[model samples]
Target: MSVSNSPNSIPCLLLAAGRGERMRPLTDELPKPLLTIKNKSLLAWHLEALSAADVENVVINHAWLGNKIEEALGNGSQFDLNITYSPEISALETAGGIRKALPLLNPSDYFLVINGDVFSPNLPLQGLLDQVSALRSMPNQPLAHLLMVPNPNQHPEGDFYLKDSKVTNEPLDGAEKLTFSGIGLYHQELFKDLELNVPSKLAPLLRVAMAKNRVSGEKYAGPWHDVGTPQRLQELNAAHE
Candidate 1:
């Protein structure tokens, strides 16, 4: 669990386990993270971003077509990062997959996690790193800190509300309902009790933490794409082309 490249480095886990059912025929042959955009794999883009962020270690969890991910990324040397894979026989959703890979992560009390499907090139890791340091020093630490954004057309209702930098389930008077960017920093304790290899969703855990006022977040107005459908993927490629 000591994934640090140094005593202070924060390790990151990239989630790549979803079946991408909406992506169907394309995902039939390749995992969603392996789908290309502007000639680069989705996972590759994150790897490069992480490397640029100075995050030296990464643990990627994959299920469908997992081997091909290993084939394409190998040991992560190309990206100047230490890449480790956590293979799942079946997609274990979000929380379960994190529980399964906890042992492979840096047990620095808190660690970074990013969803592999979303494209948010500007999602700042340094800010998350600074948060990790500040939170660690607090006598009462929050379970997670999320990056939120205005509801995208695909998810108009949004997921949670963010008020004064706090994430909440209800639309509190001053809270702004927003969508989770799938980028966060979580304390290891959040997944400590979760059963490994079992399918579990992240929303329930986050909601529970929100009820306890243990979740915090920020709104990000930047380029982001979920790429859930084939059309979105095509649009991204076409725009770049």
Candidate 2:
């Protein structure tokens, strides 16, 4: 399961359309994705990493301060990648956003998706890419492959149970349960039936797929941050400083 170092073969979608109500004043004028850490915008970190991986094209969906995102990362030529934007008048929830971007993302069966607000320096992009490449030849491919992480203090209850690399909504007696890291590799068929321009969440879709054993996941134990509040953002920045 060897994939080319060039990530151009796989397009990436950065989900940046969330209205960061928790981030408040900082997000009043800037989108959460534009918030800075170590003096670099959060989305910038993703762009740099994708560029390093040689991911040629990236599609970003933005709503709050969407224009600023465009202004800040135009064409992505500076980062060695082509950038396309899907503007939303209102923040379309995760599933909706991905559904809206399908036309731009067509021709490819699977794509990489990452939440713009998370800071995971050690995200296993190569491993996920290799997995997706292998799944491409399977007769019944999984709808998604999630990167799960230990539940943070804010979400200790966890989301899904992972057993033998498969994701399930039902908790198994001995399987480890973990939180969705907001990072994943998703196949287009996952959102094929989603209605256009309607707000929808990703969890429901994932749960349905989980029932069919169409989802796979891996636990990631690394430097991962769910930059939800201003204090956490400041702390991350200070640590880097």
Candidate 3:
């Protein structure tokens, strides 16, 4: 699954609406995505990588301290991309946020979505881009292609099982369950049933798709970190330093 060498104008969504409850004092005033990892906010890391991957348009949804995100990366010009914000009155969880941001993410039938709090500095944006074509060509009419990773200690139970390259909610084949990397390329039909602006979780919607075998995924063994805690942030910063 390889994409053309010539860069294409791609659209992407960065989910940055979490309140970061576990990150406490650090996020008391600032949003979790704005937390600095190495002189760069976590969102900036994704923006830069997306820009390099030839992704020209980005939509970011926010609720807690969203203004700070706009102030930090206005228009995404500095990173060579056009930035758009889908502000929510309240944090609308994953599916809801994606629903709210849908208008801005339109025109492109398929788009890449990344979790704002994760610290996957080496996320394979180009690699994910490569799957767009396959998703379009598949006769199963697949609705989403996820990036899967080995479960971290905090979530050892894992989220879904990948067998025959298709994501499944159950271990039907006794395959090991893997954690969703919070990164995926999605098709609009997956959210066709979602009510716009209403809060919803992505897992339930994903489960529905999995039951129909409409979801596909690939394992990513790259360096990935769930920055859900202060200690993890400190460790990442220290490691990078």
- For candidate 1, give the lDDT of residue 235: 92
Off by over 4 Å in 3: 1-9
Tens digit of per-residue lDDT, candidate 3, span 1-241: 1232543345789999999999999999999999998999999999989877888789999999999999999988898788999999998899999988989988457788999999898788888897887777788878889999999999999999997688999887657699999999888888888898889999999999999999999999999999999999999999999
TM-score of each: 0.95, 0.95, 0.95
Off by over 4 Å in 1: 1-8
Worst 10 residues of 1 by lDDT: 1-10
> TM-score of predicted model 1?
0.95
Tens-digit lDDT track of model 2 for 57-174: 7899999989999999999888888889999999889999999988876637899899999998756576677787677767779999999999999899999999878899998777
Model 2 pairs in collision: none
Give me the overall lDDT of model 3: 0.89
Q: Provide the clashing-pair count of each candidate structure.
A: 0, 0, 0
Which of the predicted structures, 1 or 2, would earn the higher lDDT when compared with the native?
2
lDDT of 3 at 14: 98
